[model samples]
Every structure is written in structure tokens, then in C-alpha cells.
Target: MKTLRAFITMVALVVVGYLAWNGYIEPEPDGDSTAKPTATAAPPVKPAKGVTVTSFRQASRLLKVIPEDRQAYLRSYFGKGWIDADKDCRDTRQEVLARDSLVPVSKGCRIYLGKWLSYYDNKTWTKSFQVQIDHLVPLAEAWDSGAYQWTKATRIRFANDLKEKRGLVPTTTSLNYDKLADDPQWYIPKVNKCKYIASWIAVKARWSMTVDQREKDAIDRVMKGCPDRKLTITRAKIGLLPFAAGTGTSNRNVTIDSIVYSGRSEKIILRNTGSSPAKLIGWVVRDEIGYGQYRMPKTVIPAGGTLTILSSEGRKRLDAAGNPVQHANWGDVWNNSGDTATLIDGKRKVADICRYTGDNSGKARC
Candidate 1:
């Protein structure tokens, strides 16, 4: 009887050990397991640090230089209010709070307590209400630029755009109120001026919005101060709908327009042939050799617009030649002998490819 009992106990121990090894039961805090853990919600993506000079120059060139046309302000035109566009049961405001909060969210869409860093004033807040969601490009400003002509649906998307980080920012309430439809000339806390201007221009370019002469001049003046920074605006996939009639397709046709493989100024040029503006925010340019890829900065290519990307060394050389170099810098991009330059969009789709053979020759057949 003792032997049988001992044998049964041993079998039970083996079974338990197998189960534990296979993760049939939850392991203790320190135990290891082979089973994959269930996935949880991903953290919110942080906003881009600052845009490059190349991207800002491109966006500036595309901006319409006109006088501001004041229009009547109507909050109702944009939509009811903070919407749960993502179907996450949380409104846009709550989403922003949850994203910017230092502490984890407690209960159902409520961020009762958390820490927030305000970019506008470079202040930190412990209370939720102290921080307000700021529309980087105000609705009235959009209207003056051309959104007044947009459909009600489009206007709502622009107003409540949670897709692009630049579209909305969490700032101190006082600063939000103080910035009332003003251009970049308004105070943006000296430290954050570059990022602030980049976000402003990016939001405008992404939405195909225009800028008046004063707005353009202000942006240009600020950009002159940040010669090395570039602005690359990637298009937000969420909250955007199909273009209205005669607005053309949402697809942006970007191609590897040209490549300068040889000489002192080696660079790749891209062009948007589509009727709608193309956001090159997440696009990648690459070469076959070394498989080196250069991710584009957040920028927009207006219809029929062209963007030039130069290597870091090339940009420095060009800047020395008295020409204001507006080119995205990819370090040592091309092979002198021969290489292939390919353009890939945000969706991982191949947009265009250019190839060249380097016989120590001047310029590839791109």
C-alpha cells in the first residue's frame, strides 16, 4: 500500500511539473513560461521631435501666399465635439489625456489624475483640466486658408483630427486661449519654437490647407533660424475619408523623379504627380548596395511638387556653395560605382525605383 501511494504521488508531481512547464497554469511572478502572453494595448506614439530644413522649405514653397480672409467663426460647423472616432469607448479628449498622462489610466476612460507636459508654455500639469487640447492649426485659420470651401464632413475630420499628432496638442489652457487663430508669430516658448512651427506647417500641408502672405512670411522667418532641421509630414490614415467629388483619389502618386549619382552634388529627387497632396512622412528611400535606407521626414508634396534628398556630406558641401540647401540628408546614400534607388511609401508599397551603373561616369541614366 505504501509503494502504491508513493508511485501515485510521483505521477501527480510529474503531471504538475509538465503543466507548469507548458504554461497550463499561471506562473508565479518570477517563473518562466513557454506560452505566449496575451497582447495589451500599445502605448501612444510620441510626436516627432522637429522637422528638417529640407521638409520645411518644401512645405513653405507649396504654401499659397495670400492675405488672410477673415471669416465668421462657428464651432458648430466642425462637429458636435470630442468624438470616439476609434471606437475605443473613449472620446478624443480622453484619448489625448490617456496618451499624455504619466500615470496609467485607472477606470473607464477616466484620467482623474496624471502628469502632463505642455509644449506651448513648457509647463507641467498635475490636474487634467489644466491641460487643454489645442488645434495646432485653428479651424478659423483653416477656413481662411481654404477649408471654408470644404464639405461639412471634411471640416469635421480636420477639426477633430486625432490621427496626426500635430493636429492636436495638449497645452496649458491659458496658452490655448491666448493663441486664438494667430500664426506662428505668436509665442511658442523659445525652446519649442522649432517643433511648434514644424507641427503647424505639417498640419497645414497634410490637409492641403493654404497660408496667407503674413503666415508664410512668419513661417519662413522662423525656418531661417533652424537651417539644419527638416519637416516631414506623414499622412494620417485614421479619421480621413475619401475625397469629395472632383477632389481626385486619396492615393498619392509619388515617383523617383530623378537621381544624381555622380559629381559633387549627388541626390535623389521625388515628385508627386497626383492631383492631391502626398504626405511623405513615413516614406523610405533606399539603395541596393549596403541596403541603406533613408526615412523621409514629415513633409507634404503638393500636387506636381518635387522634393530633393541629398546625402549629409553632400548637403554640407552644397551649403558651402552659397545655395540655400533644401534637401533631406541621408548619410552616404549612393554607391559611386553603381546602385539602385527605390522609393517606398508608408504602406510598404514600392512607388518607384531608379537604377544606375557606376563606371566612374558622371550622372546615372536615372
Candidate 2:
């Protein structure tokens, strides 16, 4: 009896223990149930440097095209060995794609270059379906700058040279066509100018290109602002000409109305003070700080007028005609290439000549 009673108690305890374990213990989570995930921190963005790059634009005047007489020769020469003429872009686009792109592909006859990134405007696109093929030196500019005299073969080579075409930086098609051939003076991007100038110069130098006076002046102006040596060509869009009024004649009476200094050049406010309206030829004199003194071309200031001057720091380093802008510390007389000016007889004149002895300070009181 005692043994049976003890066994029964043991069994009861065992059953209670088993019930507690089964009822209280939690089961493992099913495969479908999941724990919440922790959130991650994002990376910080950095600020842009000093200046931002912008789109490229055409200069003021319309760029001219090569003369018709040379077209046939160029076509025949460029067209030669073009066995796949029906579908391919001859050699110009093909070579350009090969040179400018990272991965260039050939589709039987037509060549296709991969996508490109435009540093100027920060746009990206592939060179597929007639995209990305552009002119390095614009076609119109070539015509005006002596391409008119080139033989058809020469023009054709110029038009389709892989080397030249390689410079056809991928930019907005509209902006490229807008430049049409005008000098940088009339056309240029407001930002990213240094790159634009350098690139334009590289193209001009490569082709041994000649420019008109305006074009030459444009090149000079652009080069003065370039900071980098390699970032030559960039995208561009034209800006309004703030100081193109007195471009033909020099030595015109100029007023120093406004003064602006960009990292690259100086912008001054001027007016036409000549008796008859004059064309601004070019710059002649500079101030101590290297700004242009704005003069008449023939060293003649008009009878009753004023002209403003624009200058670069480079100009102040040299004389009006490419000599040193030396100070007149040698003798009793002030002898700097650029002396300050005052209005005299309705004309703004520099103090360098014999008539204006004490007028170098640029004070109206004198």
C-alpha cells in the first residue's frame, strides 16, 4: 500500500511538471515572422568649389561656312575609301567616337560611341543615333578664317579629320549650332569661361587658324581668364554684351563710370565721346593696376566725347602696344604707358601727351 501511494504521488508530480513546461514555455517564432530592421545613416554632400561650370554659347556675329567651290573636293576626298558610305558617317563621326568615347562600337558600317558626360553643363548621353558627333572648330568659323581659300580636298579633310572631330565635345546640339562660327567676343558662356577660352585656343592653334581683329580680341580676352592648362573646351551659351559699344576706333574719350573686377579680367563702364560715331578698333593704354585706358585707334581723341575702357591684369603688365607698362620714375615727368585721365574740352583723354602735364591722377578737379 505505501509503495503504491508513493508511486501515485510521483506520477501526479510528473504530470504537473509536464503541464507547467508545456503551458509556460514560449514556442520559437515561425519563418514568416521577422524582427524590425534598424535604420541607416546617409552620407553627407560636399559644397561646390569656387566657380561652377556652365553651358557654351555662340558669339555675336553669324559664323560663315566654307565657300561652295571647295565643297566638292572636300566631299570626294572625305568620301574616298568609304565603302560603307550608305550607313556610316564616313570617317569623321567614326574616328570621333573612337577617340572621345570610352567604348566605341561598330555596327557593320555605322560606328557608335558610348555615352559622354558634359563637364560644362553636367549632362550625360550616349553617341547613338547621330548624337555626340559635333564640330570642334565650328564650320562657319573655318569659312571666314580662310577656309574660303582652301581646296575641296583640304576643306574635306578639315571637316572630317578624326583628330579635329575628337574635339567635338558632347554638348547641347542647339548651343553648338548657335555658335555657327562667330568669335568668342560675341558668344560665350557667362560661367566656366576659362575652360571655354582654353579649348577655343587649342582648336584654333591646332588648325593654324587666322582670325579677324574682333576674333583675335575675343581670343585675347578669353585667354586672360583661363586658370587651368588642360581643361580647354567646355560647354557655353551666349551672354549679353555689356561693353561692345566702342569696338571700332581707339583713343576715344572714355569715362570711368563703373569698375568691376572678376578673377580673370576688369569690366569698366564707358561711353562713345567722339564727334562722329566710331568703330572700336582695339585697346591702346592701361592703368597702374593693369586696366585698359581706352583710347582712339589713331591716338586721336574726338573733339567732345567720352569713352570707357575695359582691361585685363595682363594689359597693365605691358604697354598699350605690347611693351612693358613702365612707370615714369626715371625723370621729373611721369612716363608710364597709362596715365590717369580727366575730361578736357568734352573728351576723356589720357595724361601721357604734352598737353596734359599734371593730369595723371584722374581727378576731375585737374
Candidate 3:
């Protein structure tokens, strides 16, 4: 009887224990749950550093093929006339005149009397007044190509570009008017037809400008018949005209890239999207409200590089080279809700402006 009782008690105990274990069950404690898993963030993709083309054929191919972005391109959209980047009295016209003239500037940055050979008509010119400074890629054509999307400051630069030798030419007023905004296909120069086409392709490539099917076909047909030579082209968006105006040798385009409105790490970043260094000295950056003006120092932003302007402490800070970082105490100036940053040249002319509508992203690429 005692043995039977012990066996029965042990069985009862085992059943109770099993039931209790199942009733008060806990998870494996491996940190797994029914919640959805968080996603891993992706790394940022960098922009193209730039491009180097070996020939006119290659350069021509480099142009992005797109239809004309025809907005009623106003002449004023590109800003008034020329820029005196060097702060010299000579604006872009006189600068180009002084440059293209076979003789030195007749007087004080003026090209009153000089010798010039017009590549368009293949005629030599004597008086400066006889010839006008012509944009190889006319502004109208540029707007039709891709510049309609550019900023006012950029348009001003393009209109007054004296940086690249191929961009601006001294030509007779008659031919200048004749060419107007026509591409090589429509308006062919009596002399240097191939040369004109090459330059057109080059300018288009340099500025990252696009060509319509017709424009592309015209250049392609021209290239096939000519002896091909290597042509180095850059993709800076028609490389906005010149560094500090004409002194810039390479096609230089600068843009107001991003802005961080507040905090100790607040900053406004400007990037030289061009392949050449851009002179930023004497340039002014200001918020929409008048007092937030910060003048750029004597500095040049190298191609593909950046100029970061800090807030507050940046004013007294020195770079690694012992130069001032060129900054503004913009925390109080830049409104987090919405704001605008305008870049003006030494002449107090607007160069570029970046405007942002507030967002959670914490930075504005206006």
C-alpha cells in the first residue's frame, strides 16, 4: 500500500509541475519580438568629380541629349552686360576687346584702336567700335540649351564670360547680329565652320549643357569630316563664366549649395562645380534681412572643393593655413522656418541666391 501511494504522489507532482511551466511560460529572451525590424540607412552617393574628353568627337558625345527647355528667355534673365571681376574699370566687353586686339589697349582699359581678325567673316577689323564682343554660344542659345534652369548670378557670369578663350570673340556687329542665337547648323561662319562647330560642342560640354537632336546631329556631321583631335572638356554646367570674371582661365561655375540655419555647427556651404578655381574674394553673402551680410575674404574656391562658412566662432577662426575662414554669426540671422541667402559680387550685383523652405531634413539645398 505505501509503495503504491508513493508512486501516485510522484506522478501527481510531475503533472502539476508540467502544467505550471506551460501556464507561466516566458520568451527565449533572445531580444526577438513581434515588432517590425528597423531598416539600415544607406550611404550617400557622391556626384561625378568631373570628366576629361580626348577629342571633339568624344566631347560631342559627352553632351546630354535633351530637347530645348524653351522658357520665354528674357535677355534680363542673364543679368546686365559684363562684370569687372578684377574690379578694374574694364568690364567684360573692354576686357575681351583688350584681349582680342592685336595691339595693346588704346587707353585706360579701352580698346579704341586695335587690330582683330574676325573668324566669322574672315575679315580684319581696325577700330574697337567696329566690332562687338560676341558670346560664342549666344545667351539665347544657351538658355534654349539648358541655361533657362540656371540662377541669375550664373546667367550674369555666362553673359560676361571672359575666362575661356573660346567663349568670347571680337567680331563685326553685322555678323554678330547675323548669328544671333542660331546654332552652327543654321548659321555657318564663312570661315572656320569646323572651328565654330568645335567651339560650340566644347562650350556645351564644358557647361554640362545638353543638345537637341538637331544640334547634336549638326555637330556630329561636322566632326566626321574633320581630322579628329583631343579636346579636353569639363562638366561644370557651361562652366559659369570666368573666375573673378575674366581672369579665370578655366570655365568656372560656383553655386550656393547648402545651408545649415542654426546650432553651434551651423554653416553655409558653397561649391565650385566647375573644373577651375573661382575667385570669391570681395563677394558678399547675406540673409534676406539686410544686416546679415558677410563679405567673402581674399580666397579662391578650387574646382570640386568647398567653402564652408560657419556661424559665430567662425568670424575669429583661422583655417589651417592661418587665413580667416570667412564667416558670419548667422544663427540669429537665418530663420529656421524659412530664409534666403544671397551672394553679391564686389560691385553689389547679385551673383547667386539660395532660398529654403523649412523642413525636418535640417539642411537646405536652395
Best by lDDT: 3
Tens-digit lDDT track of model 1 for 1-366: 999999999999899899999989756554455556668989966666542234667766756676653443456658878788888788888888887777776668666678888987789998888999888888778877766446668888888777687788888998888887777756455667878888887888777777877677788888788754566776432233222222222234888777676666577777778887776545667777533556554556667767777764333222332222344444556666778887776655677888777546555546
TM agreement with the true structure for every prediction: 0.49, 0.37, 0.51
Error of 1 at 143 (Å): 1.4
Task: Please give the lDDT score at residue 134 for candidate 2.
Answer: 53
lDDT of predicted model 3: 0.72
If both were scored by TM-score, which would come out higher, candidate 1 or candidate 3? 3
Query: Which ten residues in a row are the worst by lDDT in model 2?
Result: 325-334
**CA displacement after TM-score superposition, residue 3 of candidate 1 (Å):** 87
lDDT of each: 0.69, 0.44, 0.72
Question: Which segments of model 2 are wrong by more than 4 Å?
Answer: 1-90, 104-107, 111-113, 130-132, 190-192, 228-366
Which stretch of 10 consecutive residues in model 1 shows the poorest summed lDDT? 241-250
Model 3: per-residue lDDT, tens digit, 1-366? 999999999999788788778986443444667655568888855444675756767667777888874543457667766778888888888888888888766669666888888888888888888897888988988988867545567777778766567889988889999888888778878778778888888777777678888877877777777778767655554333332343322222767888876676667777778786776645667777655666555577767777778766444444574333555654456667888888776454677889877655778886
Residue 58 of candidate 2: its Cα lDDT? Answer: 36
After the best TM-score superposition of candidate 3, give how far the Cα of residue 255 lies from its true spot, in angstroms: 32
Candidates, ranked, TM-score: 3, 1, 2
